[model samples]
Target: MHGLFVSDLHLLSPRSACPHIETELADYAGAHKCIVLGGDIFDFRWSDRGGHDQTLEATSRWLQDLQLATENTDIIYLPGNHDCHPDFLEQLEKLSQQSKNFSWQPHHLQLGNNLFFHGDILDAGNSLEDLQRYRRQFHHVKPQSQWAHRSYDTAVGLRVHKLVPRILHQPMRTCQRLQNAIDRLNLDDAKAVRNVFFGHTHVPIEGLKLNGRSFYNPGAGMKHMQLQPHEFTFERAIPASEIPLASDTSTKPPSK
Candidate 1:
């Protein structure tokens, strides 16, 4: 079976880009057996506060449409930190009830020889570290209002643009950090799997090897002018060497 993988869609209703992504994903799902959403499927906090009810309804409708269109394909939704609310379980239950193909799973999933995670728990070389650092640096300046979320997001966007090129090209430190995380995970006898997929970096990277395993981050569906959002398809019968690697290393911007 062939599978599709995507992450960091950060979908919102008013955003035309997100709708386009949904349409594209639906088309892709027609040929794939499964679609794995790595994480950050929604910017829930921002949507809850900044978005109107129409946005919520539209997003929900889009999801339903995708579920219907991809009836033969399994849609796996993994919760990211942004969408990991206490009520997440209830929300997912509602979503599952609304669509036949849609299902919500825990942060991690094991499929055949592969282990998939939102990659937040890997806790190394993630963009979140920089984002946290910036947040701390401007904590006093940042207001406690909901608008602060947008401000922080904007700041992170600017910083990532400046840093990503340097980071992806000379990524020794980052690669080491990611490898270390993979090593720790492999230490768990039960969870020891060869292939891994993750997405916190927002940088679409493939061909990362650590301790005889491969790691892939499909990047984001949202496009930032500098980096085009990407989608990945994997064939179960195809060997690792056969997959085409992506050349772009820049982070895709959130679709507006």
Candidate 2:
């Protein structure tokens, strides 16, 4: 069946251009049965800022509209660490109350023979050492004070917008962890899961195969000039002729 997949919309009032995405989604949902939102739908840092309540209310209303627009389609949300706060439960409840087609799910989900997660929970894998070094180079700026927060936000925005794309594309440890996860999944013969989907790396990836299963990371919709804004859509039903006959049976390496 036809389905839409997206993540990391990071919608906030000052910078949110989500209407275009939402409009496109509505058009797709009219003909699709399922819509999967991978993670980080809201930039929690921005949403926690002043006037955020108004933004939240507007977002809620937009979601309701989406529910109405999709009619019978299933809308599944997988919260990322950014939006996985305890209070988000209440917000999700409100959305559910507002629309029958909307629903929220845990970090991991099973769809037919596929598994999905935000991918952050997989740990940084062997990259912890590198990340630690990078973290040290960039001093920890507290979010406590408004000035500090602004400075930190600006710095982060600059890094994501100006630095990441050219210098840091993919981390070795992250790729390792992903491979580890896929390996672990293959041990479960009963599950018969042959595909995995995730977000949080904010990198658009598709058609990659690890072990025997197809791997997909739809990337993020959040725009940072230095980083690419990636999105993807997939179909669940594949023709038998398209299925690979020989599959990799080797175990994935262990995560550090």
Candidate 3:
């Protein structure tokens, strides 16, 4: 099956949504059998779209439109720390009930031998319990001031956020953490999983192998000059030789 994976859009409103990339993404969705929204697709905590009710309404409407636009494709959404608010969860549940093509889970989605998640659980050490607790904290976050967003925009413009992560090798660290977390979980289908796909670190991984399993991250889509969502076909196996190392400074983006 053909699949498209993306994460960390951090969509606040039309102003920050990057409509051009979204247009491309919509086309990609139409062409794929399924699309997994890895997480942080909406930015509730820093949303400039208005207060809670307005932001929720806008995001909900956008989701409904996307669902309608991609009628034949399966849409699987896994909420990240930023978008896991209770009201958003309710909206996701309603959409899942109303649309056969739409579904959402709080943590991860597994299809065939591929696994997809938001990856926040691996951020501060590999702990599913910690991720849940962190997500719970998202419910209490109030929207930040305009100045905060401005400072963030400045950092992005200067590429500090991207550079720091790369220098520190955040992607490899995250992949290692994920491998440890997976082993501890001892999932019944662990043997079936071959590829692990995740986001939230905002570092794109073409491919990184650990313990015989491959990992990938599509990077963040939020006004960053990184690679966009990546497409994969489950029918074809990934070639190890073609994958680049995280240390390939000339080819890979900054880490984390």
Candidate 4:
């Protein structure tokens, strides 16, 4: 089945990923039998600590609605940098267990030599090392105990509640540099991979090739440049405003 690949939805971001926009996306996704969400579908960093469950429920409503519109369609979510928090994973695991059309893959997935991931592989280190780096950049990690991680995340949650739009293009550049380094690193598994689909970069680029392999970045589903007026900032969804959901302005699917 041909799959619709989406990335960087950042559902919690006020600057992007609004109800009307996601509803439009759901309409497009309904045309596909399978849906692969590469990463950052949800930005836990923006979740209100007190109203965390309410936030998750609100973000997931559109997904649930989409599933109903396209029965039997599989929606696979791969956690990205913005959604790698332990609390988010635990909630996702529960949702996947309860929802028939939903499932979660912790790491990358391979389909006929095509790799699907959140595009974090281009980072400085392995997953653990990356986690360490994440703690430093986003959260305050303690060497004392594993419990400290959770406590610090609570603090970080309130402090860093949204993505910094100023660095929006950084991930895109990093993805490009990583593409160049792939050949330099000479990793056999990487070489064997023919098609790589990732979405850490909010920049939408399709059919980009490097080192004879096809690379695609579905870009950020939520943070579309066309929707914004000036620079991308904390712009919330204005339903009454003149916001075209899709570039083509397609009709949305029935949110049954």
Candidate 5:
């Protein structure tokens, strides 16, 4: 099925979220044949959505509504670092088992020639084995102090969140690191894969070719992050020459 990929919503408690995004996403789901939730759809560490159980409950209800609203669409969820809590994983697993349209994968998902992941594997010193191990440990980590979220929110408001990454050239560095990581892993489909789509850097990119693969990231749904959903038809393979170079297009700025 043709699909749209979105990530890094970093959804907090309903009281703090942007309700319009929920409506927008559901509308996209209805229009697309599939929706791939790339990762970090929920921010457990920053969620004031009550406690862990409450947050999961809210998440479950939200998913149920989305599913009901878009029964013909497929939902593919790849867990990101933020929402990999053990109990949350259990909930997703149960839902996947019970529902025909919903599915979840812990690490990476391959659909057609495109590889989808949360992009955590590109971290500075992490090996392939570290992926699941890190996620398991993340479950036990407590919520961040409210002050920390407040400070981050302030920075996001000031658009410093976008500025720092631009200054450091994080997107280019991330692309290089991702290429290295891919070579190191030597994925079974490495030779066949032509495109890699990921989220985690919170920086949106399109058609950025490095090391022979076109990379796409939809950025984040958090305020001022310029959230965008990418559409991909899982039919013909995208030729390298068909994709434009990143230098040919201006990167979308985070919304004010």
Candidate 6:
């Protein structure tokens, strides 16, 4: 399948948006292939504070155009932490119910020789159900109080961001750290999967061989990577190049 892989767009509205990415999505949608909304496509917490549907209508129109562009393209929506909201899930469900081109899978997806996930499966060990349950269990953060969480997370995220090595920096590990604490789980079974591609932690690695398998990530807030025709070539929108070991957090090229 011709696939367009992207993650962590963290799409917001008016004040914050990724128009180029959205445009690319439209172009790829016309190809009648596949688009993987890896994770963090929506930030529900932000929606709680900033309000929802600010950009959703525009986004829906884009998706509509995409579906109209091609008769066979499949747009897969995979949930992330921010996506684990009742209303958002409901929206996706309704859209999927309306057409075959749209689909919502709670967890990871396996396509042909490649495995795709938001990466929480390996890093957090939790499933979509787990995330939703945790959200439900938590005392709801009032709109007025939401800023506290964002501010705290931002302070921590910035600190961690500065500490991460340059090569592994785009994804900023802070999100995954909080997610792991919330899920309290981990899965070491990723090694069994071949050609695994994921988007959590936002760091993108391409053709980075490990344990006889290949891994690729498009990174957070970066361009989508395309897999088509055959040979896989990554056009990184960020500088997540496989670098010489710089820190425990940074990735390394396969040893010779």
Candidate 1, 146-195: lDDT as tens digits? 56656656655676643664465333454556665555443334345667
Q: Please report, as a residue range, the 10-residue window in candidate 3 with the lowest summed lDDT.
A: 247-256
Ranking by lDDT: 3, 5, 2, 1, 4, 6
Choose the strongest candidate by TM-score: 3
Candidate with the larger lDDT of 4 and 5: 5
lDDT string for model 3 (1-256, tens) is: 7988888887883324466655665787654477888888888877887588888988888888887777777778888888888778777767876776777766765666888888877654445566666677677346667888788878878988778767655767778888777775546588888899888877889878887888998877666546568676676422222322213323111111
Clashing pairs in 1: 224-253
TM-score of each: 0.65, 0.67, 0.83, 0.62, 0.82, 0.62
Off by over 4 Å in 4: 29-32, 48-50, 124-192, 222-256
Q: Give per-residue lDDT, candidate 3, residue 140.
A: 38
After superposing candidate 3 on the true structure, give the runs of residues whose Cα lies further than 4 Å from its correct spot: 13-17, 30-32, 124-126, 167-169, 235-256
Q: 194, model 3: CA deviation in Å?
A: 1.1
Off by over 4 Å in 5: 13-18, 30-32, 140-143, 167-169, 184-186, 236-256
Model 5, span 51-156: residue lDDT tens: 7777888788888888888777778788788887777777776787677677776666666778888898765355656776666555634556778768877887
- Give per-residue CA lDDT, model 4, range 53-79, as digits (tens): 665666567567766766655666777
- lDDT digits (tens) for residues 4-72 of candidate 6: 777776665112236576667666654336677876775544443344454455446655666676546
- Candidate 2 achieves a global lDDT of 0.55
What is each predicted model's overall lDDT from 0 to 1?
0.54, 0.55, 0.72, 0.53, 0.71, 0.51
Q: Could you give candidate 2's per-residue lDDT for residues 150-247 as a string of tens digits?
A: 76567666755435632444644455567666554433342566666777776666656655766676655544421232233454743322322111
lDDT of 1 at 182: 53
- Model 1 scores a TM of 0.65
